[model samples]
Target: MNKNKALFTLTLVFALLFVWTVAEAGSSKRRGTAGAMELLIPIGSRNLAMGGSDIAGVSGVEAGYWNPAGLSQINNRVEALFSYQRWIGDINTVYAGVVAQLGRIGSLGFNLSSLDFGEINVTTTDAPDGTGETYTPQYLTLGVTYSKEMTDRINFGATIKLISESIMRQSASGLAFDAGVQYSMMDEKLRLGIAVRNVGTNMRFDGPDLEIKVQPPGTEPGAAQRPFRVPLQEFELPAQVELGLAHDVVASESIVWTVSGSFLHNNFSFDEYKLGTEFVLNEMFAVRGGYVLAQDPDEDTFYSLSEDFIFGPSFGFGLNYPLNATTHLKLDYAYRMTKFFDSHQLFTLSLGF
Candidate 1:
């Protein structure tokens, strides 16, 4: 098909999907009802510092999480990234991803993330203090992504992810899918991105831990007890649709300044708005800052009270150094403001070849 015709068809498809997903989005009434929240956690330090507002401009391996479509923008033939985050409640998160470009075809990426909750003492109804036993909870996700440049300015991508969670003897597993598209205009100075994330099957926990010994109410004194299995309810995964726009306000040889913003339509919680800015110097040093705000149901204003949100402003910096003619290394750090807990910190390292 012609370029214009293809763009028109892609836009129509995205609009239809947006309408269908938004129709199912839940308001405040459905908050806290979703399962496998680990899918919503942000990964790379650069994007996290931008409050996840760079969906349109993000590129390379790091784009696997923010917007898979951006993976098509990888400059090198191969890229690798690793990141570590100190999340709230003493939890630690580790993420790693790699992307490779295929000549005349597309880009492919793979990523893995895990959460460390540490060990906690086991407690039961009879033992209020502790049971002298400790168990660690495991949360993990693995994803495979494929992205391609449909036209000079249009890119499309999709990802399939496996989500797994285990606590003690009980465990749950499910699958999720993500898709996104990015369009560039104004001589590549303006960009727009749309994505749908974490839409998948419901998950329920089941294992030996759910079985218990019980007796019939009207049974005789010597009657034998029976093993009963507790029934569990399945929960839906958190789903959201994101729309973003980015523009290069100042583009020059030595300095480039870009501003980006996005709106999130959440299925299980309040909607959110994010704004971020990045300043690059000589293609080696960069600084970024961002702010996130949620919608308020009680008030008619555009944003809710800042105190009601868990995460607020964020800032970070990055350094890019060339290793050789065809290799480069990047180091990044980010800090985020939080309420009722220690602030979040992250470190990331990336290599391109």
Candidate 2:
């Protein structure tokens, strides 16, 4: 806690959670349902290079979501990742991750993701009511990341999480923390990163229908049924402050080139930037692209950005292969573009030993 007092306590907790979530959505009276569908929770798979350097030169098991200090660049005992998205029509996304490398006492990761809205048909008003409850809107995240390579050009990491959310029954769960740092230069080409994600606390949803209530069945006094707490609700997650940079151009023993950039500090939003590039043509063939925004940018950071469909411009592309050389396998793809939903795709599969 001394990087200028931890970046001034993470810029004063991201400016007081972005001014209390923009004053609770400018005093919402039910305006746009308080961030629904998060456009599918920004589906990810290394943003498929569409966001290059995905936080800091991603490595095996997809670094558990792009950074855990690049998972110590994996020494590989086991690493895996899976993902899929079909945005633009009936949105859908599924993600998976795995990692293991306990060689000197460091390295372990596991992650799972889900987002689907393929079922819905439950309503009520008693018979003016449609008593048929069909539900689906569950999100889960169980994570663990620990990395070490604290030398030869810096590396260190941390991640911990347990989060859950349910829909038709209004559920909520929480716990979160993450930390990162990575640096590699010259000979290794170049790389730099920083992370301070999520942090912790603020998920409140109780059991028993938040104590269900219904009056007028016999003039009962009043004031009892309460469990409200939902305004972009959170139990400490989605707090971001990532900065990244990358470089790798070794063209010749096959070929390799990478370029990346990223910066974000979204407490709920406003402040994002991404630029990417990747080309590996021989280690097994690969290609990539990138672009993202929060207020149109690739360079420019002093502070500024309050909102706008989260700023536009986004792109993607991917490829990879190699199933031998001690053991290796790879595949990745990505796409992102939104100003009003309808553009996002991701896929990832990896292995290394």
What RMSD does model 1 have? 1.4
Residues 188-295, model 1: lDDT tens digits? 999999888998999999999999999878999978999999999999999988999999999999999999999988888778899999999998999999998887
Error of 1 at 325 (Å): 1.1
lDDT of each: 0.89, 0.62
User: What's the CA error at residue 132 for candidate 2, in Å?
Assistant: 2.6
TM-score for candidate 2: 0.31
lDDT of 2 by residue, 1-353 (tens): 34445445534654565455434321122323323223225434555545543676776666656567677686558777777777655757677778788877767777777667687777766754556667777777677888876566666678886777787667777777777777677866778777765556557555554555455455657945544532444433455656787877555678887778887655554456778777776766666777665542223433322234432444554455545667776666666654445555667666666
Could you tell me which 10 consecutive residues in candidate 1 have the lowest summed lDDT? 297-306
Badly placed stretches (over 4 Å) of model 1 are 297-307
List the pairs of residues colliding in candidate 1. none
Q: For residue 111, what is the lDDT in candidate 2?
A: 76
